[model samples]
Target: MDALTAEEADPVADEHGAHQRGGGPGRRPSDAQAVVPPGALSPAERDRSWSRLGDEDFDVVVIGGGVTGAGVALDAATRGLRVALVEARDLASGTSSRSSKLFHGGLRYLEQLEFGLVREALRERELMLTRLAPHLVKPVSFLYPLSHRVWERPYTAAGLLLYDTMGGARSVPGQKHLTRAGALRLFPALRRDALIGGIRYYDAQSDDARHTMTLARTAAQYGAVVRTSTQVTGFVREADRVAGVHVRDVESGAETSVTANVVINCAGVWTDELQRLSGSRGRFRVEASKGVHIVVPRDRIVAESGLILRTEKSVLFVIPWRNHWIIGTTDTEWNLDLAHPAATRADIDYILEHVNSVLATPLTHDDIEGVYAGLRPLLAGESEDTSKLSREHAVARPAPGLIAIAGGKYTTYRVMAADAVDAAAADLPNRIPASITDKVPLLGADGYHALVNQADQLAARHGLHPYRVRHLLDRYGSLVHQVLAEAADDPELLKPVPGSPDYLQVEIVYAASHEGALHLEDVLTRRTRISIEYPHRGVESAEAAARLMGRVLGWDDETAREEVRVYVARVEAERDSQTEPDDQTADARRAAAPEARPRLEATA
Candidate 1:
């Protein structure tokens, strides 16, 4: 079964004269030549993208490409507004990709008495599981350890009962109480003395980066002009109101002014920065909170179910991620580089000390395969304590034609996006409908369930094992067929990439073609799990991955080697930084490597 050739892969034109297969516009002269094929972006296509932005005046311009920004673009475009979304980097390059990978109702939020947030998140979780992205979000169980014997069960059960009543509880099983012996049966990795009993509750998980990227792609299909490597330099103001923005194409260093009726700032941690750029007095400030997580091999932990335990400062999770266990997540206030937040030795030690207290066999630094640190953009309040700061989001229009949204959990990104778009519409000339994204499914979501049912046939057709095909389907949804077509001419693409055991060569090629992976690091760290799954953090596999990417990205030998060197240094610096005692020291060590080319530079 060979992959589809270029000519065979072109999308058919429908009666409306739109290319039904590719993601682009329709019914316009410019739309006819703007079609982009899956699995790669051509230089001509890139140039056309910039030209289209200049040729048309968008009704709304969305800044940022995280989940929230992607959601805003989708909402605005579907509402019949001419929209454009600009990202300084690739989609989900920040906190969106660095989350614990959960699509949960946040049972812990219940403890904070954030009933509204929990209920809203649960409803969104259900929507993702059943309608929006059944392929991306799935149910997973968590074991909550009960240290105290008698009072634990009743107290936990009461909370679980409330959680079940929240919207979309039917998507997963109800919570179950387990005695000490029973709990041990499910998680023998825990020491006998660690807990008296446990309560198992259901929640959901997802591939956050992939889900976010799909949101942007789906918005593009709906007529939103979406481009990465485009930086919002400043706001375009007309007297007292912000009319649009001045943007620079990072790839070509070309500057252009985009005129829109309204502008939405969904920059996440950089929310306040964008506000400052506009010279607008923002209603609220954004504080960066650092969270770090470590990935270790699954064989080191003998747990059938993921574990959620209470720590002195925050909760800890030992999650099952493919062939590894994802652990840690220290939350502390940070005022450092927003691009890369490094984890210190004390941070890692805090997690190991707490988790090892429960594990029968403890883990050490050498056991870690991957380390990632991300900054959460929390809305600033009067409180000096970062943990007590609000997780609820805010939508503010300090200046006319500009809307800024910040401070929300990953699970509630849709609500944040909808609100941002709704606010932007208030400044538009025409009456815009309320957001319909709640019922909207992302790209590849419509036929996901049906494809899952025919995984066997799909696997055989692609010359892949049934399990392998199932994995791809789960990740790509109905897009799996498109990816498999890439390798139709070369059967060997079906085989796994030599150094990266979890991914196939074809997937890497597909990442360059369809997923907007412009650089080697993008492919390794975000497009796939190679960065976190391998012991060397993709250093060993960098050359092979780079070669595969070069074929698509047109990288010369010198450029390929430079990319590999930069990636290797980044991993080394990250490993070295983790040994430091605090944020200041860790950041200094991490900064030893050459800085990643600015997001604008990569796209240019």
Candidate 2:
């Protein structure tokens, strides 16, 4: 290429040998480690993490990189414990990235009388809104349309009153009652006869994948070794006690043993599988519930706020995403593929049927720009309905030195992490300090509010639009400068990606270099969300994004071409799978494509 980006200038090459470009075909420049942002999960950082995993003894070894696993790593590291986190895939590659992207107290949980779960989640939401992740977590208003004229208003009002009393109303506005005409005025898309009145309330939403990745980065900053694409093959045992794990690098298929006092499995749906691999029985069995969501243009829903409707089995939400409306979430048991959960024709029809019940302009499959499915790891219960399973998390020391934590919502991940680490205290040699993650703001959280206030000035300085600056600030927080600075080598990087105007070219490069994106799918899907946000499903920008990512990760012509081909195949498979009638057929079609990580072994 022409010149090396800041993060690409590191001399260290990861185990895959992608970064060894000294006097080679596409040589760039010397080391510029100073330009690399703090807590950046660059290729060099991955190399360092691999070395640490093999050489150092850890107090805690966490097996997973979802929100909860990242949270545990952050909690353990902040408490001065020697910690290392390993993931089979990329960070937030599973359900963590595929969530409905809300940080609110579960309003639906109130009907089940789960007071403690709702209260704890509301507290976390407030912390994220005001103190912890103000840039990422944002306030969003929702309208609950009243169907029945008589008792519905009083019932919803009473429930919302309790919701507000339990810390849900802070940082955001409380509930507001409105007449049918007033509700119609606020949301013109709603049918006149759909409801008699409405109640509006506020909650918080986030980019779940970005939040989880940032958690891992923050954990790395606090002295935790975080490595992705490293799968735990088997457990390392010492007589009657579980001691450590044998992990294989999925990319290179290289094996290494990591010794630890305790191993915490936050593997989500893969919890039971990990327990089986460890030759131990878990305290609770985890059942996978598949939730499917569809994305459409923002204009499709003519509402300033989102909508929450009651379904026969569960509640349905038409949540507002940027430039799009994310309508979702059919909860059903999933016993198929855990890696790539497929959304079927039935699921899409169900969501459309429920959402269209209220909308004046009903949505068709043609209106959907994207479809995604995620699996929630619920604790198995007597009830067959997955929606009825409790969201409360459970932790257990299945073996002497192995701790498994499962069954929690995304909003309460920090609390879950604290609890998991606290469970490991008995096995740890030293008395571990209590969790201080609540007080520790993420890496980019500090000075975020100040930066938001200076958006215009920063935009002027960077030769960009004020709106673009604001968008970057919301996504990167104070690290907006770190992102924008990558354009110093090539001013063209400041321009937006082809076909995807919402994201800049530099952001794709940053994902590969600073955000631990090993594949083009990672950048397009999780890092920037271009895949689900656009009609072309990122195919329009696949080649361009791959080229941008290749520059930072040092991919040659052939490697870049292969990456594009794989991503295109995956997208096509997803589209084809969506047409399938049921889960089995959908999964078969979805699993037909080649995996980005070619050597990644199946968890089974």
Candidate 3:
């Protein structure tokens, strides 16, 4: 079917009706009245959220949908505050989606004597693994190769010992020393001369995009008005004090004003731009540092555990992604477009050279499946080196009733959010409760362990393999049933996407029906890793995924075709950009690609 029948569309109206019943001016829809999942950010919910944003007065209005902004919304809502979060693009469409995907304590930061920052991040990491998002975040082992035989082992071991103890890590195993033979046995892909020995240590990894989206959804469950494709144009100020914001819908090109007691800016790399728009002096300047990562097939590298190597500039990680290996990250200053950070040929070559130096069978350009680049919002420092800039975030009241927060690592987003909300509390009329997000498990986190244990039975019931069920369980946790339930009417939905076998068609439908996926790029790149995991970079599966999404979003055949066309163009543009030698040329090539949300670039 091209579209969902009336019966299927009934749930969409019911979801909106449920919100209308209690989600009045300052109130939220209670769980008892919600016919749909409370966390569902469907297109219907997006409209409702926008309507509420235009009509109601909020205690806090968050500008940005990245991890920190989503975190702020969750922190505020959980503390009994009426909140609204508006994003220019889809959630985690920025730096949040394009991270190293590691929840580490920043082992390099220790050398810089950032002990407090390391401790804070490690604590947050432990929380994610144990209490917060065990389904999405799990223990990942990394082999830190010791090049020098003598002092390196003791030195690295000491740092790791501090790392293990600082966070009160209990769920994951601690560091273990290994001989050169043992290290080689663990990862046969590595060159024997690459290391004298290795120290294996436990850290955490997650789908950063999914985790950030889940954060926004969890906030929605708590009655936060979370809406994407809404761009902030200017501040709504009453004389000197900031009262709210004037926003424009990127999809419709409609303008509206949202009134709030406090407007928290979590714009990340665009912090200065937003500040300029608000006509306020920013407390601290933000410097954009571009980090690029390359993906290759799992078979390219023979490893049981991930590998961490020291580069001349910074540390390079060979992360073990499911069915693939994720190796990256070149840290260089980016002065071009913030919306689309492009990776140059030099960045890719730099990564390949560093990683290939140790790999027994060096990876070639043809082996690369995908390449992505993201900009980190660093607190600008006196040092010329972007790597030297601190990841520690700063919150400032640049103007009355306005607060801006920027510069922090992904691992410590919760803490950064709590601080932002704490700052917003001062501007709020009523006293708010302290942030309880540390205790609040994100949606799908509650019964994740139980679902993991029941994976085999679920597979049997669904007439699928045990591994498939386990994969769904990891991706959706207790909500795996909901994802599978979409395939009820059409059993074909249970099958994999045409070229992207890793993800099922039902996932594309569910992404639009439940998660807030407004565009094909959002689903291909952020909601699922098809764009990065597959060699085709989602182009092969775009049409099928778009049609599936159209069935849920009520798109016509032409619109679905347009989505496919834009997505293919995007992949091509990225490929073209990667061939460029420098940032300026790459930026032009990448920026030339047609946007999924065309109005976003036009309006911004």
Q: Which candidate number maximizes TM-score?
A: 2
lDDT of 2 at 454: 84
Model 1: per-residue lDDT, tens digit, 1-604? Answer: 3433443443432121332222222122432344445322333345556887777788999999999999999898878889888988778889999999998887778888888888888889889888999988999889999998677788889889989879766888899989899999999999999999899988899988888888887777677777888888888889999998999876567899999999998999998789888998788889999988899999999989999989888699999888899996889999887877899988888889889999999999899888898889888743333222234888887788988888898898888888787777669999988889988887778767877888888787777888998889888887776688667666777889878877888888778766777777888888887888899788888998888777666778898898898889998998889889989989899878874454353221
Error of 3 at 599 (Å): 1.4
Q: What tens digits encode model 2's per-residue C-alpha lDDT throughout 378-412? A: 88633233222234878787889999888999999
lDDT (0 to 1) per candidate: 0.81, 0.87, 0.87
Q: By lDDT, highest first, what's the ranking?
A: 2, 3, 1
Candidate numbers, best TM-score first, in rank order = 2, 3, 1
Candidate 3 lDDT over 1-604, as tens digits, reads 1222223322222222454112322112341243456778876677778789999999999999999999999999899888999999999999999999999899999999889888888999999998999989989999998999779899999999999899677778889999999999999999999999999998999999999999998888788999999999999999998999999899999999999999999999998899899998777889999999999999999999999988888899999999999998999999988988999999999999999999999999999999999999988633233222234888888788999888989999998898888887779888888889989888778767877787787777777889998898788877777787667657888899999998988899889878889899999999999999989999989989988887767788899899998999999999999999999999999988998888775424
| Ten-residue region with minimum lDDT total, candidate 2 | 18-27
Error of 3 at 283 (Å): 0.7
For model 2, the local distance difference test gives 0.87
For model 3, the stretches where C-alpha displacement exceeds 4 angstroms are: 1-34, 381-391, 601-603
CA RMSD of all predictions? 4.7, 4.4, 5.4
**What TM-score do all the candidates reach, one by one?**
0.92, 0.94, 0.93
Model 3 vs truth, CA RMSD: 5.4
Q: Distance from true position, residue 135, model 3, in Å?
A: 0.5
Query: In angstroms, what RMSD does candidate 2 have relative to the true structure?
Result: 4.4
Residue 510, candidate 3: alpha-carbon lDDT: 81
Clashes of each: 12, 0, 0
